[model samples]
Target: MTQVAELPASAAEARDHVHALMATCPRPCGEDALTDALLIISELVTNAERHGGGMTGFRARVTEDHFDVTVEDASPAHPTLPGERPAGSVGGYGWHLVRRLATSVAVTPTARGKSIHVGLRLR
Candidate 1:
């Protein structure tokens, strides 16, 4: 397993990290996985920056069937659905989209903050 450990300054930076990893790593499924992986990374990093008080760490790795992305942030809050608000809300789309696209999602609280792990299956 090859893992890239990088704490990007922004979502763009995080995407660049993953993009570089894709160049060196073999694609288990294809381009679609790349697209999904990028989108997931973007959402995770962006959410951390906007709502979680900025991202603290980032890691991405590819296994035989899984492309996993882990992001750590300053906030300890777990992601929630937008439906908690009114029907028409601007927030929560990122969390919802991430859960919909990711094969697995996890939240772990740390001493400084929390880490969110999201995985996409390459099948």
Candidate 2:
């Protein structure tokens, strides 16, 4: 079974929402995982605001095997996997970091917007 929650637009609010969701997950997800999740969420939200034409909403779902985080925004621009994080780059490392931390990552473009989902395995 999976529990789902919606996050607000504010970064602080989103962070708190994700923390609370992680706390309630069935499996024991570590602090490091939680921190990484939060960072990924922050990056996604920031991208939504800057590139996706503003975030519509975000969903956090905890499944029996994994924890899934999905961010929805107003634009149809699908997120891509970067080859590498260039040195001296101030930004553009969010998706890269998310892919590194999560067991799997996906991006789906819908009629409304695009959903960037990251899955963290529950061991």
Best by TM-score: 1
Cα lDDT of model 1 by residue, 1-123, tens digit? 668996888889889888777666664458888899999999999999998988888889877668899999999888778877688767888898999999999999999799999988977
User: Considering summed lDDT, which 10 consecutive residues are worst modelled in model 1?
Assistant: 20-29
Tens digit of lDDT per residue, candidate 2, span 1-123? Answer: 555566585767787787877888777787777888788778888888887988887888776557788888999977544555456655676777777888888888878888888888766
- Angstrom error of the Cα, residue 24, model 2: value is 1.1
- Backbone clashes in candidate 1 total 0
Off by over 4 Å in 1: 86-88
**Residue 101's lDDT in candidate 1:** 92
Which of the numbered candidates is closest to the native, going by highest lDDT? 1
What lDDT is reached at residue 121 by model 1? 90
TM value for model 1: 0.90
Backbone clash numbers for all candidates listed: 0, 0
